[model samples]
Target chain A: MLAELMLSALLLLVTYWFIVTRRLSSAVSAYSVQSWLLGLVALALYVDTRLIGLLLFGLLIVSVKGILIPRLLRNRVAFALVAGRETSYYVRFPTALLIGAGLSLVGLLAATRLAFQPQLLPQSVLGISLAVFLLGLFTTIARRDAILQVTGLLAAENGLLLLSLVVAPGLSLLIEVAIVLDVLIAVLVMGFLVARMRDAVAGTDTSELTRLRG
Target chain B: MIDPALLLVMLATPLLGGISSALVRSDRVRYALVVPTCLVTLALALTLIARILATGPVSAFANWLYLDDLDAVVLLVVVVVSTLAGAYSIAYFRSDAQGHVLRPGELRKYFGLFHLFTFTMVLATVSGNLILLWTGVTATTFAAAPLVDFYGSHEPLEAAWKFLVLAVAGELIALLGFLLLYEAGIASLGSAYNFSIPVMEQAGPHLTASLGAIAFLMVLVGFGAKAGLAPMHTWLPDAHSQAPAPVCAMLSGAELNCAMLAIVRVLSLVTPANKARAGGLHEALLAFGLLSMAVGVVFLISQRNFKRLLAYSSVEQMGLIAAGFGIGAPVAAVGALLQMITHSLAKSLMFFNSGNLLLRFRTTTISEVRGAIRVAPASAILVIAGALAIAGAPPFGLFISEFTIIRGALLNHAWAVGAGIAALLMVAFLALMEPFNRMVFGQGRGEPLPARAELGLGVLAPGYILLAAVLVLGVWIPGPLHSMLVGASQVVDR
Candidate 1:
């Protein structure tokens, strides 16, 4: 239980780093750490429950999300990394951090109000997961760079992975595998789009993608 | 008693087509493979529908794949629209190739993605496992995003990017909801809990109320975004308008309905546990429905681009269907089912006409394409008819379905809801017709019609066939179709 809560806190911290970090490379690395923490949480649950599916899912999360996806993103958007540091955001850093804190509080309150079963993990994990999820969503909305947006999405999905581990670790292996595969493809496609955006719009900044608006 | 292997064939035909299309360099060979593949899939879909109506639901692969009346209804729409769109793509792309608007490689990519898109939708519709259904819905984003960016220009890429971000984010939220639902199921079913539809339904009545409510709300918002429900419908118009016309037709006419089917599936599961929860869910559905209708109508009135206007109209039509289901009256539910079919046929026809206009005028701006009747008389008349039909005019299928929905609302003594629907439908009707009337009859912007502007029989046949189907549905709901709608609605109304 102590381990789970600490891991959850570390996960939330990494998500915060992802939101406020200036360097695009730092943000990508923060997301990888966040995903690794999620896999750790899943592994912690497996230790408690002795469920083999949870064990496999934890490894899957660690390898695919932690290792494979981040590497893919770094390679795909190396140009953005070379450009160095996310300079523009729809929401500035201090304000974004404050908002993330507030969202975390809201998640805490929601966790208190809702009746999560919390099968084997600590209950606070639910609130932390929700906070991570919301912050990831905010990151996507707040960031201007296309690669940053993709990182935000990855962070958000990690939040979901954390929640699923706590609430329903018994979910079928087939489904877990399928969900991971879908995210993999989504990343591939988003990477492709980011590459295309760089070519067509001449920058990775999504705000420049303004020609299609009503 | 139909062979379940037929289901496997139905799913594989498109995958095979997609793979072959990608491998073949020649556009003619790709088209030859694609059209027949679509037709065979349609025939298989029809056969399954008949057997389902006759023999009840079909299940295969250890019941991981299943199709009942409700699935059949959605499958029917998907197959019909995709088949038509698939057949029409040859002409649409041929014209684009002639104009040098698309390269040979791009055409091959288009057919490949088009079939893959169809495959994902079919997979979602036939999936009995809730998780598999969710996976299929998410896969569609990946499949269709490239198609949206087929032009690979600024606008198309922007649209595709937005579409991808919004859709992927929404599906993640939905994943949370589905997981919560599974948690709720575990409370009663324990280790027997599977994410299959039947298992979930079995677990429904015993689900924890609070968890179930949260799950349904999340699912509503998440899937609602995909279905073009308002507040989350920001991506719909941009993506739909920017995609190729045939792709737009499938996206609007078929894909949105499939997402709605996912919502209905969850609703069916969530509503059975408690009355208060069911009522709250219905109210929520109605609120989103009304808001979408209003948003769709407001945007429809001010729209400059014809394709975006149609896209907003989709938002409105989907809202009406959502509202109909929200009413929870048997008649309303049935009307919503019929509305799904009518809207699919009519909207696809309108898009096909829009494709025609785009081909001739080289612009989707309503102001630029005046005097269309003088250019392509057949397409112009069909456009006017399609506009009227989609706007719920009399003697059109949408009118009957919309009326049935209103009548169902009134029958339930939801007078305010009934009147609200009526007023919105009226405003939408005028908003749709005025622009279409101008486009079809308004003077050409003093420019001579382009030579070879008239459509070939191949391009126009799908439009006429869709028009005929829409008209026939308005006048008469065929016996088998009526039964299918009733059965499908009963699944929702329960």
Candidate 2:
């Protein structure tokens, strides 16, 4: 349990780094690392609980989210880097980092009020998971690059998956598998759109996708 | 009674058909597959409803696939809209191909995705499990995102991207709510955690009120966005306008109804447990519903693009339906169900007619295309008729449903809310009618088409059939249909 909480705090730290990073590649790397931490947490729980389902679920997470998604994002990033495009943000890096920290702090406070019993999971671990989720959402809102936005979404899913590991362990494996499939599909589709947007607009900047506003 | 095996067939047939359709290179063979596939789907859906009404809901495969009266209502909408859209796609695509609006290659992709989209909606409607329902709903975004980008134009791509991002985000939040609810069930029922709706229904009264409130509210916002409710409807106008006419028709008319059903199902499941939670859910839904109508109407009055105009009208009608469901009275729920059916038929017809106008005028801007009466008289007449039917005119289905909703609201002593909805409907009606009139009846700025065939009867046939159904339903509903709607309404009433 102590190890789980420590890993969750580490995950939240990586999420904060995601917001503070200037390079799109680093943001994707932070997300990849965060997903790996989640898979590790799942592996830890599986070892403790001796549940084959958790073992399989952890392996699934590591391969699909932790490894494959990041590789896809990295491929896209390599292309963008060769093109010499930077990961631009609506908010500056410093301010965005400050706001992200503030969000984590807020999430820590909000986690105290959650209705879960303490025996299920420590409130602080839950709070860290929630903080990770909020940071992911902030990453999406603050970034202009479509690839980073996809990474942010994956980060958010990672947060939720982490939370479910501790709080809703009774959730059926089938549902978990289905949810993972959706995230994979969402990333694949977003990646395709990012490629298409680059081709059409000659850039990956999403702010220019303003052709259809009222 | 319809066997559960039949339900599985209904679900599997389209998915298989979609895969096979995508492999076909010949447009003729693909379209030949389209009508039969839709007919089989419709036949299965109708049989399912009949069996449900006869035997009082069916569930099989460990309660993974279930059809109640509520599912029956949405299934009807899916069957009708998909069948008509499928039939219309033949003429629509032929004309569009001829006009160079679409290549034969694109048509193959469209038919492929069309069936897949229909399959997703059917899956969403019949699924008894909350997770399965969410899967179906989210899969729709996956299927339709490419369809929204079918034209491959910059505008369509922009719309598709926005639609995908917003939809996936909203749906993910909904997943959180489902997880929360699952945790709540585990806390309460331990070792008996089930995502099945029937299981949840049985456990509803045992659910903690606080958790149920939080979970349902999250579900509301998340599913509400997908349903194109107000304040979260940024993606609706762009995607609806940019997608092809038949795709737009399905998206606006059928998909929205399916999303609404998902929300309503969650509300019904969670609300029966606690009154305070139910009241809160009702108020939230009412607020979202009212806001959607007002925003939709405000946008409708100002839309220059006819397709966007139709899209906003969908928003307004959806708001009305959502508001009726929010009223929570049995009668009002009935009104909401009736409105769902009427809106599906009428809106799809209007979209089909708009497609014909686009084929003739080669434009979507209402101001740019004038004298539709001269350009394509049959489509123009049908457009006008559809506009009136959509605007809640008398002798049309919407008029009856809207009136019934108002009466239900008043009967429930929600006088202020009822009156407000009525006023907004009136404004929306005028907003929709005025633009349609200018386009169809106003002076022609462009020269009429050269001596050529009007829109083929095949293209116009779907619209005519839909309008006729609306007109007949306006005057009177058949006994089985009326009872089905009433039964469906009762399913939602706490």
lDDT score for candidate 2 against the true structure: 0.84
Each candidate's lDDT (Cα)?
A: 0.87, 0.84
Q: Compute the lDDT of residue B172 as modeled in candidate 1.
A: 87
True contacts kept of each: 0.72, 0.46
Q: How many residue pairs clash in each candidate?
A: 0, 0
- DockQ, all models: 0.74, 0.59
Question: In candidate 2, which residue pairs get closer than 3 Å at backbone N, Cα or C atoms, i.e. clash?
Answer: none
Q: Please provide, for model 1 over A1-214, each residue's C-alpha lDDT reduced to its tens digit, 9 standing for 90 to 100.
A: 7888999999998899877787888888998899899898888877977889989999999999999998998888787787577666788788998999999999878887876675776678888888999999889889988888888988988888888777777777888899899999999999889888778877688888888767
Q: By DockQ thresholds, what CAPRI class is model 2? A: medium
Off by over 4 Å in 1: B1-3, B276-278, B444-447, B451-453
Candidate 2: stretches off by over 4 Å: A75-78, A81-87, A118-120, B101-104, B276-278, B445-453
Report lDDT (Cα) of residue A22, candidate 2. 64
lDDT (C-alpha) at residue A203 in model 2: 69
Q: DockQ score of candidate 1?
A: 0.74
Docking class of 1: medium
Tens digit of per-residue lDDT, candidate 1, span B19-69: 999998787798788779999999999999998899888888766788988
lDDT of 2 by residue, A94-128 (tens): 78878998999997997787677554457897788
Best by TM-score: 1
